[model samples]
Target: MSTVHHLDPEQGSLGSQGSVDLPVDCGQARLLELGYKQELTRRLGPMTSFSLSLSAMCFFSFFGGLPTAYVYGGPVAAVWGWVAASLANILVGLSMAEIASSYPVAGGPYFWCLELTRNNKKYTLIAWITGWLNVLGQFATTGTLGYITVKHLGVMWMLANGHVFSNAETFLAYAICLLLAGLVSSVPAKRIQQFAVFSAITLVFGGIIIMILLPLCAPKLQPATWVFSSFFAWEKEEQGIPTDAWLFLLGMLASQLVFIGFESPSQFAEETRKADRTVPKAILWSIIACGILGGALVLVLLFCIQDRDNLLTGEAQGYAAAQIFYDVFKGRFGNGAGGIVLLAIPLLSFFNATVISMGTNARMLWSFSRDRGVPLYKVWVVVSKRTATPLNATWAMTALAFFLGLPILFSPSTFLAMGSISFAGLYISYTVPIALRMVMGKSFPQGPFKLGMPQPVINVGAIIYMIVSVIVMLLPTQLPVDSNNMNYTCVTVGAVMILVMGAWYLPYWGAKNWYIPKRHLQPADLPKPPARTLRAKHGGASNGASPSGSRAASVKTMPSTGSLPRVPSLDSQASPPYPSVRHPLHRSTSDDGSEMSVYQPRLQLPDIWKQPTPPRLQRREEPERLPVLREAPGKGPMVPPHD
Candidate 1:
């Protein structure tokens, strides 16, 4: 049996101690085999992937959400509900990881959808729908994070100055936060990523500090029974929770939302080496890491609740988490100094997660735009020559995120309540492809990181979980649903889907003409295959064939949409190897005038196609031999018959 190889961080690949079976840069080769050339540097390992996922987890969301749990089902939901949500997320992550391992492409969700449905003619329409789901999901996520960042800043100001920040002031602050996040994302520097990693480190350590301090600083700890079995019954009738079960589901949203974005790491597929293995591992472990810590943190918080009375009555200065922190610190130390320092951790988490998420979003957008599925595709697809980044796509993503937050200014809670919109978009994006993959029944290639026998179970379970989560999130948080407390998820998510349909059928101007990406092997099903051969004898060109009896000259006719022709092996014995083809230049007119690009099938060959025939293969002159005179008497006449 072969031993598992550890990742070599510097080289960005797995290093086996024993004899190797695969060739160098096999991941890169596989990517080409999948029909796209590797453009991003494949230097990320499992650790980086984990960092990305962990960074996107947003510790602030967990803290803010804990109160929601307490108000609904108290310590019981905060503790057990977290466990259920984590398990559900793991199932979702497992399903996502399975596909990510197989495809290992940027913007994997919709790409997987396109590939899984390749046999169907309506794949374009399906992919178009899934693509917007991913885009809108990512936009809502960034918007949510940005809006929350403003809320955090507002809370800090209120605590320090005893003045509430106005909605307009909050709007201006929100704009600046998003703009900064966007600009930072567009910079296209590798070093910028390290800052994000640092932010993740801060979150982990901050959680540790909070965990250690919560019990030590508490006036007294609750009994094991209270921590595990007891539920806080809220007397407020306006909450309108009909039953404990309903409240429990509502309370679980924080855990569910915090866990949802773990799939974001799959967007880093191109950048991670051994991506089939590394990315999936990254995705699974990231959630596990967050879950483990989040669970412990929840336990500590539940056991250390000093005053539930202060919590139910006061608004906690408009932040539920702050009361918990301040109350614990004030009880032991006579001041909330420790709590003040702890509050700042989420700020670091905010900065870290915002950049990490936006980067993921930009990469995904860039990949989609590369397929010409996005509007202004030419602009979004361009890579900045100097920075080697998809800056245009980054800026475009940032702009949409900015606009998505516009509703926040008018009614701050609208955007917050509409948080379910993010969940709907993200979970829906995940559900369709996984469901399709299941229905498609294993025709597509499997990657190294498969779930084996449990794959079917995992995929289906994930679908159920996500569908249920979306439906739950779209439901009203409280029963007395009014305009102020209503959930807008149904309207927003439906509206987005309707827009996608309209775009697809919008007469001549719609996405009917949008480029539908085909599989690397798909064009083989076409009338004239991409890789055709000419079996000519000895010397010259066959009818309608190149003079060399090979495809070197006909390379010009290969369409950009198809995969590169099957390259002949140099050492093959079946036939002499064909000479290589160069990347010939072509000019295409765009809004930005004429730009030269390497004509596709996108392969780079060593030998030039425009070379003279090699001497060995040249035709040889032969001495004319007279046809044997079968008729002995007519031998002389047979020679004179020629004019």
Candidate 2:
């Protein structure tokens, strides 16, 4: 029933004059319970949040990378590998949902880490590292999405025209794609949400269309046994790795990549309505949707393969899915019809993926900068007045992604190496907070939406899965790794870790002062106004006055209690009626040069933690009094004024 007054940052004021009532629900109340006030507009409902997360994951885009699994471990790796990775990722999503419910902030993992660590210095350091790592991961993911979209475009071009595009042309295309995605991200939040929803619908129906059309059009199809039961065994000499088992494990990267960005909902927590409940549901549901849809797509693609040797060694040597599309539709229908479908569906999905990725990156950067977690925090934290979005962070991230993608022009291997760090960085960032939560054990505060009794077990499993994923990502993809084909993900990850750690220790960085203030972690640090006061001040109709009336403008008086209501602590177990602390009496020189003892009330932890309520005022029942008319000096007396 409480009215929430949203802050207009650009105008440096609270509420809009003559604005309608905006109820403050438990979700927003939880945000206030934390240190931050609601800055971003909560326009995203549960469906929009789910669509955003699903778009970021972009399972349909996973088709672009399916060839990696096929090459590494053949049919079984591409099929079953997806199933295994999806299950592990579900665990990760669940663990993050539990934390996201407790601390539903745009700061995401960083804020959760701060809450989990409390005031402990060592754990605080861990929280700082988590924030930087998360920022890096987001940047890397953005770059990767941009790279993939551009790569897909280049492949599509080669497929249509029968010519391989050079790396320079691909880089130019990458820049253009990044620009387009940036533009999409800079739109208003509602528009962005709409775009996400549209993209998700297109992806789902497009996937279904592909699933149906490919199976129906194929002149010859692989037998059920080959599609579901058969495993394409590989000799040690034929695989990239030394052993078949290692190769299969390496092939799991394809599925792992699809699940990498499922944490997108948590990053958009501030923008999502009813974030505590909605965000967790979105996270869990998106994973389930992606797993089911992605698994089906993989199975369809696998079954529709009519010629394995042609897919692996012929004109479609590197791109099997593209080959399947060309062979199935083009062979049955006309070449033009098949080409149109290929460009329309998967290519469009890639474009949507890039835009969503860029948006996610901007949000993470803005959240991090809001806490002074990044250098040049002032510039990045500026939200646009026009779009009500983080335009600066959006463009900055686009520029960073552009630069990160520049290495592609030099060598595809180098670009792949750098881009691969995103997978490792994201998993590592996810692991840290979950690990801390497990360490905190019973002391950790459970949010409204939680895993109940199985949280600890799930946390342990998620940590283990993340650790394995990180290791797999770091391992070299090819045997006898040389400069040309070596995986530099480990080197990149190590360098980033060193840089972040070194910056924290360096005096010039001043991380100790700005990283994460201990006060921000305390619930009492932020105190909200009473519900009635907020309604009146914000000009809400619920206050029983016209929004523009003088009654709405006038401030209501509180009872003469001589003390303010206590602010509530996050700990529900804390007893009510918190006691106040008194400061020691200090002797001060008075104006007459006499010493006087001055005493002041101090805010103790318990006092600040207590929940505050508005004091009820009794209405006066006396009859209205008439105003007395005053006569001007040396003039006739005036008539009395009526009440």
Candidate 3:
């Protein structure tokens, strides 16, 4: 059934001093390869497809913080702020797309830093700092989401009945949300992808349905005069702020919070299939579409607001757009049924955000762990054999997400305030790696994707965003710095605090435990040897090289002893040593017009040993020459060589 060959002991041998055994594959070597392939599969397609794009839109829609922006800069600034942010968002997306194309790994900004850094000692310290800052940034985003989730649910409950949730009710709601979010993300990576796809689809359509149904169902709709120009027009002087200053700075700063997640997809690039292409596409599509949709929906609602006083002054007044929609529905459609449906529209988005957010967070945590940045390297870096998901990272993020949500019970604004602080921190965090990319002249490994833009164009885009982000981060949330000012100091302090945490990785701690810088292992780089089986007794190869058909007739066999070719073949003759199949790229030793194994383009080891030795039997020292026999007896054992 199969070809079998036996060793000839008299022919030749491997000839070694110690025992030789076949190499084995085990441990992280196996784990690394398995994880690499699994992550590749994840990046192949968008988990949420178009819906993820919509969630991005919905996020900015309810930035209730805009009122604070309005309180500081007036309505004129708020309108123009959206314009600046939209353009800035596109630039930010492109810069990140470039980074994703290069590194295309889960480590995101930090990994990019690791690759681009010139000096390991200095750049590594910087990259490590950026890594944990990213971790904090994730926590900040989760807190922000928690605040929004609680705020909206609270508003819905109030509108349904006429009461706010008591202290106990508030804690229970946050606890429930945290637990549910954790459990959902704790599932497998593929499962998360599928769920994200479904969530993205639902949220995108939900917004579309709301936009269509709202204007159609409203009894007294505004004419074109009121809808566009008038709604966008604002009286800046009434708000006591310079229109130019307000529009340029206040609006730009506030809008950054909503656009924060535009680069979220990049965190999963390593897990993405064809990341260079898919990640950049997903990011650009999400930002452009979401930016347009968010601006349009807010403007549409601005047209429909009948009473500005009631809109901004209600007990739960920050959510004027949502409340206005609900009020209109109740007044025109029926007894509160239509209004409930409208409220449910955005709420559905939170559901999608809940799952996707956890997925992103878990991926970031997993990437950090793989680099040994986290405390538990072996356990945290492990991917679940069954699910191929980072189970430990998921569990850890879940615990952290719950703890972060705890502040909500003490102060309603705690989570919200923390998010505002975190938003700036994240923007600052984003700028560092991007600045590094621009300063350091390097690129990531090429995959199926690349930013179609010229390098200079991409660099300029990154630079503009960096300048704007810094300017915006410095703006006061509640301007005029009175006792009631929003204390923008928190953002600055938080960012500084995050950087300070890097001190642990300074000379004493990081240097001691950190060995030489290790490159992330790729599949092709693993240790591998020629697939040859040793003969049982002779120790020579069992199946000596075979001529692969076309050159078989011209191939000459040679006795093996780990040495170079004994003699060269003449013209028209075949080469010896069975036409070596090893080291295909290397030139064949044959000097004659003899046939050899088809010369492969790739390089390989030559069949001849670099270091040769005498055969095992010949290695024994020869005995001194013995005396000659019979004829020499008379001379009483004369030396043998005389003849």
Best by lDDT: 2
Question: Which pairs in model 1 have colliding backbones?
Answer: none
User: Candidate 3, which ten residues in sequence have the lowest lDDT sum?
Assistant: 20-29
Error of 3 at 129 (Å): 2.3
Per-model TM values vs. the true structure: 0.78, 0.80, 0.72
Tens-digit per-residue lDDT, 1-643, candidate 2: 2223344433222344444221234455466556555567777888888988888888865676777887777778888898998888889899999889888888788888888877466667787888888877887888888777776667677766777878889888888988899999999987998998998998889889888888888878787777665555463475356777778788788889988677888888888877888998899999999999999999988888867878856555477777777777766775634744555687788788888888888888898887667878889988888888899999998998889888888887788777776888778889988998898888877777778798888998999988988888888877778976677888998988898888888886557645654333243323323222311244455445434653323334433223232333333321222222223222444333434332222434444445545433355468998777898888889877556
Q: Mind giving the per-residue lDDT tens digits that candidate 3 earns over 1-643?
A: 1122222222111112232211111111122322222232342365453344445335434446556444544344445567667777787777777777655667677666776674366567667766777776776676566556766788887877778886567767767776787777777666766777777666667767766776766666656554333322143444344555544475556566677666667776655544556677788888887777667665555555555567667544567656667767766756555766577777767755755666667777887776667677667667777676777777777677677667667765555555554566566667777787767654543334455547557667767776667665655543355655565446545655655554554567753257233444332222222222221222234324335632112223234333221211111111111221222222233333443222221213334433355376356778899554655545665445654
Candidate 3 lDDT at 189 equals 62
Ranking by lDDT: 2, 1, 3
Clash number by candidate, in order: 0, 6, 9
Could you tell me the TM-score of candidate 1?
Answer: 0.78
Tell me how far the alpha carbon of residue 169 in candidate 2 is from the true structure, in angstroms, after superposition: 0.9
TM-score of 2: 0.80
Q: Give me the displacement of residue 565 in model 1, in angstroms.
A: 12
What residue runs in model 3 are displaced by over 4 Å at the alpha carbon? 1-44, 47-57, 60-80, 223-243, 252-254, 376-379, 442-448, 489-502, 505-507, 510-517, 520-643
How does each model score on lDDT? 0.70, 0.74, 0.56
What is every candidate's alpha-carbon RMSD to the true fold?
12.1, 13.4, 11.6
Alpha carbon RMSD to native, model 1: 12.1
